[model samples]
Target chain A: MPSYKLIYFDLPGLAEPIRLLFSYGKVPFIDQRITKEEWVTLKPTTPFGHLPILEIDGVPYSHSRAIFRYVGSIVGLIGKDPMENLAIDSVLGAMLDIREAIVKLRFCEDEAKKPELKKALEERYQRTYKKLEVDAGKNGGYLALNRPTWTDVLFCYNYELLRNALGIDVLTPYPNLQKVKKTVLSQEGIREYLKKRAPNPMKPKYELQQDL
Target chain B: MPSYKLIYFDLPGLAEPIRLLFSYGKVPFIDQRITKEEWVTLKPTTPFGHLPILEIDGVPYSHSRAIFRYVGSIVGLIGKDPMENLAIDSVLGAMLDIREAIVKLRFCEDEAKKPELKKALEERYQRTYKKLEVDAGKNGGYLALNRPTWTDVLFCYNYELLRNALGIDVLTPYPNLQKVKKTVLSQEGIREYLKKRAPNPMKPKYELQQDL
Candidate 1:
């Protein structure tokens, strides 16, 4: 196995799904968390000055979607065939879309437009969650393929941020997605990782620890 | 070979890359372009009420990225291995990021924020284009690999919109991306498609036909 080191800020923002994947695969990796001060010094040396750069055996790779797919493929969580991977990727793309919207809402400097953005975000999240609910219902509570894929982990992590950013338990209305969360958390390695994971100061209310 | 039908607006928008892929592979596909009047009645039948749905055989697949990857894979445009795929996907993700930023800029309702958004988008495009330039320079004029991948086609289509939306020829600064555009344009099937493809009303200034 290649040595792995994930460089990111302490929060579970874009890097958590990757960490979750490693844990689920029962693989050992160096989880290198950085501070904002350290990142200021480190940013110039990065390929794109972005976080969640996964160093696979020392070479750094950027972008969470690429990194997630890479790690997911290694852990047998991606998909076996192109068609299957297509379905998996579609769900991942949707989850990322939601994550991006929530990020935008959180960082909106325009106080006047914040409410409008928030309402738009809430509606988007509801539509997305509703669709996922049907998929989860059909796939035995997994996000794709009638079993757990990286998207399940992605959904669970993004749920944390979406819940905090929206100031609502975003998954409450969708029982199927809630079940999907339960299925993901029930995995032995993920459960162990969740139990031992460090507390994130940024999103305190909706911690994975709470799920554990 | 699977029979393909792409459903989207008459404008290039999201469906053009899929069309380019089919054209590049020398495959025939039904290009179902709809107007806004028809879309209202058709939207309810769509899986996610979104366009650019790829119907393979008869099953409709939603989401552009998913559709792109699936079509790319079938046409031998996706990378062969996990690491190779990481490279391809990184470029694809970057292109998507740029496209999303441009979309936001185009739809900005706040007049005061328009220039700020425009400047930021220009900077992002430059950064992305510079990175792609180096990669294309290294890979003998292709965006992701030495040979053409879906990203090369995606880059070409996005360059059209990004150029038109920003009201500037963005590729002039980066010769390798210009070369990348030339490489995509030189494909015989793509040349034919570009020659016959309808001009987009939204981006009337820039068209792929100019490349042909």
Candidate 2:
């Protein structure tokens, strides 16, 4: 067995899909999670000062998408054709678009600015959800190449992350996305992986409703 | 020659490298650019409400980076090994990081936020430039596996975009980037391509001078 180690914060923000991929593919790996304080200290030493570094046989690789693709290739999930690969990539870009917008919301200081930001983001999410729904409809219920691939795994993780972190009912907005999430989550290996894993460490703050 | 038509707004932002790759490789393609006003009218009909769609014999492919990679593969740019391909992708991801930061700064409403954003961005740019410099050094100045490839063309276009749009003088901070940019720009076909192409239409406002 080839030795693999995934180094990241003790969170599921970016590395969860890779972990899920490894699990679904039955590839064993060491999951190394660092605390927030440790990230501050250890980040600069990592390639590109980022986490979610994958080490295979002691060689380090950076960039979450690239790492996901690498592991996905091993799991036979990355698409088989160039156009299929491109379709997978387009969906990933939308995921990043949502993530960047949410990051902006995370960094905003004033409460007054948040409503406006939230509205803007909600609008963006609605549009994105529509696109994903259309793609899902056309691509045989998967994002690309007519089968459950890495893009499906990615969509599941992203949808679940938004639910766990944003506190918003993402599925309420797009039933197709909700269905996609449920379908992927129900997959045999993925379900088994979820059964063994602990509660998500990256759960967002807003999931808890405030007591007025 | 395979028939292909690349559609984009009349700007050199994301579509130029693909254009340059096709040009440099002497591959025939339809360089279709629409006006910004036309984009405003037509975007509602587009699959993702964005331009730079490549039509291969009439079937449209969206996403700039994906199209670039597809064309790059045909033109012999994508590397052989997964590791090498990931390295190339990291550079592309870093370039997007810089572009997203720039885009955020462009739309920020509060003037007070501009200064900190610029400072934060310069720090990020320094990080990218440093790593890219070292990577280029290790690879003898090209950001590709062997000879100059589409990745180098993309990097060259990135440098030109920064110099022309942002006007931040990044080359001075990382001399190696400047050298790599110079090397790619001075290539025989690339130099000719630049000379013949019109100046890019969408110039950055550079409006936050007081904050700078």
Top-TM-score candidate index: 1
DockQ, candidate no. 1: 0.65
Best by lDDT: 1
DockQ of each: 0.65, 0.44
Candidate lDDT (C-alpha), each = 0.85, 0.72
Alpha-carbon error at A157 in model 2, in Å? 1.6
Q: Looking at candidate 2, what is the lDDT of residue A21?
A: 90
Q: Candidate 2 regions off by >4 Å?
A: A164-169, A172-179, A202-212, B105-109, B164-169, B172-179, B202-212
Tens-place lDDT per residue, model 1, B37-98, is 99999887866667789898988788898889888888779998888899888888788878
Model 1 CA deviation exceeding 4 Å by range: none
Q: Candidate 1's error at B56, in angstroms?
A: 2.1
Clashing pairs in 1: none
